[model samples]
Target: MLRTRRVGRGLSMAVCAVLTFSFFTACSRNKTGSSDSITVGVVLPITGREGKPGQYQREGIELAIKQINQNGGILVKDLDKKLPIKEVFYDDTSDQAKSAAFAERAMSSDNVVAVVGAYSTALGEAESVMPDRYQVPWITTGAAASTIFNHGYQYAFGTLSPTNLLGSTTAEYLGTLVDQRKLTKGLKLALALENTDHGVDYGNGIKEWIQQHPGYFVVVFSENFDLGSPDFSGLLQKVKSANADIFLADAHLQDYITMHRQYLQSGMRHLMISYGARGPESDARKALGDGVDYIFAGIWWSRNLPYPQVKKFNEDYKAFTGHEPDSWYPATAYDAMRALAKAIENAGTLNKTAIRDALRKVQLNDSLLPGQTLKFGANGQINTPFVIVQNKPGGKVDIVFPKDAATGDSIAPTPKH
Candidate 1:
């Protein structure tokens, strides 16, 4: 009888041990499934000098996220589960110090796998330090300074074309206008740029291009002005006095709108060209009207691309924002999120290091930019083509340069008001 009782007790103990182990295994699996949701962070200047572009960029990111979640979320390989992505965004307010602080906080506290933002070059410079320290991949859609990539950090990626390429593309398109339309011979060019890294990069790019094609361009005046200068009369007068045939100004949207209005009021009538951050903001058009006509800008993307992907994006964007997408700001941010999604899918894991490594290898097949496929270099910089857009009468914008990708004929010498 004693032996029989002992045997029964031992059998019960074994069964309890097996049951406990099985319960824990099930719980562990459930816990991992719960943690599979991926989180991404965005930092943008939603309140200051960079506010307009920031809003555009945020819209793009939101759109991409919507699409991703609608399509059944990101696939996690290790767990064999599909997880939705969660986005956390902060407004940098266009302040450099604030941008840096936000970036640090996002990386450390929010525990984001990747970060996207810093619209201005100054803001980018400030926020870049956090990515390097934390090993989180940082992608910027607005900032275009080459120095950002030159930092030797593998985590920094810029979807927009560098200012150097923008400058050259602008000069090239202008030269075409001069040659084809016989608008001006030996066109004297003047550059009035905001005094910042963006300005310096654009100015240097134009100088390099002019040196390479000397007879085509003659730079009569080159000057840098404060970003928020209220009165551009003095600068416009100098440009007018120089007799420059083409005036190139690199400025942010607000400054672009302000100075261009002032430039018109000052009666300076050279073929106006603004690169880097200029675009067709409704406010600018409402304020300047025909004055903005014929103004050319070199930018990352254009609504004029006839590709189906681009058309869909444009239509969706207009539906959401009640405004057409601008060239650089929104498109780049949209691509950044899509690219991040691709990296996560390819890595099959949420491990930061794996995603970072996979990001380098990820290639986007359905990009909105015409004739531009998305691929990252070792330094995380994207090599993409740019478009030159001319603001036409009746508020029409047409992509003029790069004949192969142009959607409409070039409007040269702009219509006289």
Candidate 2:
């Protein structure tokens, strides 16, 4: 009986050892740090209000990853091998707290070498702190608020130029119209800015330009509105009473659609209308039809850009996504991923610190953005110029500013609706 008991105990020990080995083997396969691939984390508002633009950015990032993997992935010198990227992606659902939490979770739990995400100014602001805290590299694909970079964080980088540039660029474009006699000087401008750092920077940009070049434009009315507000009727009534010749508002995708729909319904018309970086979007067009026409925006990139690489990118993006991008969202996100990839290749290792340092030094000459080069400035934001684009009747969009890149003339003092 003692011998039989010993045999049973031996069998049980052998079974326990096998189970433990299998458990660890399964864990190693599931973990991102597995030797098979390099891991990167992506946190974006894939659902909720910011979902559309965030999805576009995700498409761009995925396209880049697909292309890189097809080319045998990135080379890691330390490993002496090329490994495909394995992404641990999450949806923040456009919640500010979720954005930060997801970023923290990615850095702390996923073992990702780097992360890219949080598409809006507010969301980006929320997630920006995680990079420095976790000692991971973060690249924001969409946020442009200057206040974000002013925090002195070393691990954070962004592809969007400052919102102030977007503002000043809009003012410069409008000033050009005044100089060419397309519009008369001393035009009164009514501003409906979103209540965020983005809006403040935009308002300041226009105000600064007006101060620098007097007699060009005047601010007749200015007001800020909460984001995602349902009704802009009260605001539109005030703007209507302002009697401004030009209407300018810095807004997000949904805000542009909602506000413009109300603007048209209220019969408030201006000589010119702009929604900061929010014109020519397919969703806006689908929402407002001809209502979105004659609107101009100063944006980071356009499919109308005249470059072989830009053309190729557009084609590649379309083939991969089954539809063309209607705004600047995807282009910036695509470049952000490419920039991160280039930095990884330059670092030649998955070391997070090395990747962060390499990001500061790497530059992409084949960038799809204007100037065809992507390089981060001292504050870790790109300083590329914004191109002004206008939507015309029958669904045509054209670049109307910077004569060298202009595909069509600006229809200043827009025709009656």
Candidate 3:
């Protein structure tokens, strides 16, 4: 029998649930009858603070596997035949230690070819080691911190936008607005960011841009808040007291929901507002209603982009999951799976080493991301830029920055609270 454990939510993240691969078979209450299946391991925080997006990543991975199997599965030239993918899903429950352990099990115990997992940088960073130790390729669909790639690991790979760009892009876009006089110069800027590597990178990137471009904005107040906080009144009070002209907060979905509620209630408004990567979520829009409108965010992918394949993917994703994507989480996961499949095909063999080599040389052009291509850099992280999105009234999302790909311009000086 596979062991299981229950964990509680942490300050910045939630609890963890450990479900061994056997649970995947048990969940469906069926046993596989063939050894022809190509096994893959999937670890996710399905029950914690990052659970919502983790579930989204899981759904996206499953959808891609279903499509791949339906289209004749994966070709193994060694056997001159195709094999359907069989996934063993593990619930890391937002526990980093448990995540790595389960990943180790997936490789050492379960005979999986490769692994896909982890929705947050913390968890992804934790599990990054199992790939190289077990000599299996690990593809991370959600983690984006550059630190995960800093270590010399040959087997770890990611499929999301890096944090530096996520922050710098937003800052650059804002600086451009101020340069055009659409926004005031030397405006007071307030920073409320999460206390994590992801948050640190975001803050550092923004601050670096500020240093490079003189006088576009001034950091009047800056502070880091613990993730998963239930209240933000104290923080908002400080920000309001500072009377910053712009407010930038880096947070997760739950934090975004909680803080934004208190922010509006506090009657603190800025010439521009951003919640870092935490804004533009559908749940936030429904929970806060018009409160989220006009709020901008730097994001990985938005369905509103003009990319032809992206448009088609929105339709296919809906059909596959019976729901529209909530945010950029799924798109990255979906593309990651496709990239893996393409690598397997290119390798022409099921040999793990060969596939790993193939991944290094893989370049996917029929992708749904803005870049229109997905290729891992030498450090195993993808080179991609984020888009700026604003939540418009009537539940519509628009691309507001980087005029070349923008669907609409930002509506500044957001309506007074």
Candidate 4:
């Protein structure tokens, strides 16, 4: 009788251990299946010098999220279920340090699968390092500096094409104008660029173009200015003395307004004026009135693009945001979000490594940029063509370059003031 009782007790203990192990295993499976949402992180400057553009980008990201959720979120093959995206958004207040910090917090604390952020080149540079450190994918909607991608980091990507392309495209457009006899060959050019990675790339691109096509242009004057200068009178004086036929500046939106205001006040005029990617902002129009007219910019996206996707995006964006996009800022950002979402779906799981790998293969077929498709190069940057848009009188903007996509005529030689 004693042996029988002892054996029965041992059997009872073994059965309990087995049942406990099975319970935990079952819970693990349910945990994967019952995930409420797939979380993504977003960090952007919503309130500083970069604020206006940043806000537009934020809206673009939010709009894409809304659309994705409306469709029952992304489908994950591992879970055999669809999970809505839960965005963990933060404002870096236009500070580069803060941008990096927020990105770190998102990955370390919020457990985000991916991050999108830091709109400008400088800010993006600050946040770019966080992706590889945390082993999460990051996509920058605005930054175009090539330095960010050359670091051998596998997790970082960008929607904006390299800044050098903007410079080269501008040179190509001007060369065409010279070819058409609208502008003369050997025209002296003046470059006033913002001192940053962006500026360096822009200047190099122009010089490379000039080197390849000798006699098309001459860099009679080239100078760099500190960003957000309270006064540009000193620089403007030097540019005026250069007596160049073309004045090209790579400036942010605010700097464009301030510098142009100073340029107008200083009575400086060039046959052709370009502010890199700054011509069509409504703020510039409001601040400079008729002065901003005839200015051209090589930008990543334009509302003037003639595509069905672009038209739908414009209408949908206006309805969602209660205002039309001021420029190319929002479109790149919107595409960035869509690209990330596509990557997640392609990954078919919330695994960070899988998503990072999948991002390399994502191809957005209905992209709203100059090209209808969006794909990343080996460097994880998009190599889309930049559209050169010129501001016309009475608030009209025209796409003048890449002749096939021209929406309105290029007012070459820009009717000297």
Q: Write the per-residue lDDT of candidate 4 for residues 266-375, one digit (tens) a residue.
A: 88888999999899999999998999999999999998899998888899899999999889988998999999999988999999999999999999999998888899
Q: After superposing candidate 2 on the true structure, give the runs of residues whose Cα lies further than 4 Å from its correct spot.
A: 1-32
Candidate 3 lDDT tens digits, 1-417: 122232223322331223455566564444333448788889988898889999988988998999999998999877789988888999999999989899998887776778998788889989987888878998999888878888989988898878978888889989888877789889889999888888888988899899999888889898999988788899899999998999999888999999999988877778899999878888998899989988999988888889988888788889988999888888888888888888988898877888888888899998778778999999888987788998888888889877888988788778764
Model 4 segments more than 4 A misplaced: 1-34
Which ranking of candidates, highest lDDT first? 2, 4, 3, 1
What lDDT score belongs to each candidate, Candidate 1 first? 0.81, 0.93, 0.86, 0.92
- CA RMSD of each candidate after superposition: 8.6, 3.4, 9.5, 7.3
TM-score of each: 0.89, 0.94, 0.90, 0.92
Model 3 misses residue 301 by how many Å? Answer: 0.5
- Ranked by TM-score from best down, the candidates are 2, 4, 3, 1
lDDT string, candidate 2, 1-417, tens digits: 999999999999999999999998777657754877988899999899999999999999999999999999988998999989888899999999999999999998888999997799999999999999999999999898998999888999999989998899999999999999999999999999999999999999999999999999999999999999999999999999999999999999999999999999988889899999999999999999999989999999999999899999999999999999878989998898889989999998889999999999989999999989999988888988899999999999999987889999999888989
The number of clashing residue pairs in each candidate reads: 0, 0, 3, 0
Model 1 misplaced regions, further than 4 Å: 1-34
Residue pairs whose backbone atoms clash in candidate 2 = none
- Estimate the lDDT of model 3: 0.86
Candidate 1 per-residue C-alpha lDDT over 130-205 given as tens digits, one digit per residue, 9 for 90 to 100? 8879988888877888888888987788787778877887877777767786466677888998898889888888
lDDT of 1 at 175: 72
